[model samples]
Target: MKVFTALEAKNRFGKVIDAAQREPVTVTRQGRPSVVIVSAEEYERRQSRAWRNLLAVMEQTGRYAAEQGLTEEALDQLLADES
Candidate 1:
């Protein structure tokens, strides 16, 4: 990863973006790390993995709920109430 001060990143936005295409770029503010810039492909891959993990957790929870004789409608209502 390449580290760049916020001002430098702002001034050289194109270069930072180009670097992100190859690997992640870290942006710092006030000598502290602030943000990371990643390529779209990397972002999509991470998002897909997150969704897969979330689905696995949901499947496990659903199995447990089913074994407890919980109904789908009741689960939907409970989730809606929380929202």
Candidate 2:
């Protein structure tokens, strides 16, 4: 990742786009990271992988709940308690 201040990124927007094509570019505001610029392909790939991981986790949790005889009401009550 390449770090660039907000002003630098704005002034060299074209270079930022070019850099993003090759890898992610980190844009910072007041020394704090604000955003990352990545190629569309990379972004989509990461999003897809994240969604798949979330689905797998949900499936595993569902199986565990089934095995433990956890009902919707019990789960709801647990969530309500947490809140």
Candidate 3:
């Protein structure tokens, strides 16, 4: 990751974009970390990976629930009871 001050990033916006294409670029404000800039492809890849992980967790939860003899009706009742 390359660090750039807010001013530098503002001044060299094009360079920051170019650097972000290779890897994430960190922008700082007043010596504190502010934001990270990543390439669009990287962002989409991460989003896809996150979605897959969420689906996998949901599948595992479903399997666990099935093994515990939980049914859709019972699950719905439990959720409704919380309201």
Rank order (by TM-score, best first):
3, 1, 2
Ranking by lDDT: 3, 1, 2
Q: So what's the TM-score on candidate 1?
A: 0.80
Residue 15 CA error for candidate 3 (Å)? Answer: 0.3
By lDDT, the best candidate is 3
Per residue, candidate 1 scores C-alpha lDDT tens digits across 1-83 of 99999999999999999999999999999999999999999999999999999999999998998999899899889999998
Full-model lDDT for every candidate: 0.97, 0.96, 0.99
Highest TM-score: give the candidate number. 3
lDDT of 3 by residue, 9-69 (tens): 9999999999999999999999999999999999999999999999999999999999999
Q: Against the hidden reference, what TM-scores do the models get?
A: 0.80, 0.78, 0.95
Q: Pairing residues by index, what is the TM-score of model 2?
A: 0.78
RMSD of 1: 3.0
RMSD of each: 3.0, 2.9, 0.8
Off by over 4 Å in 1: 73-83
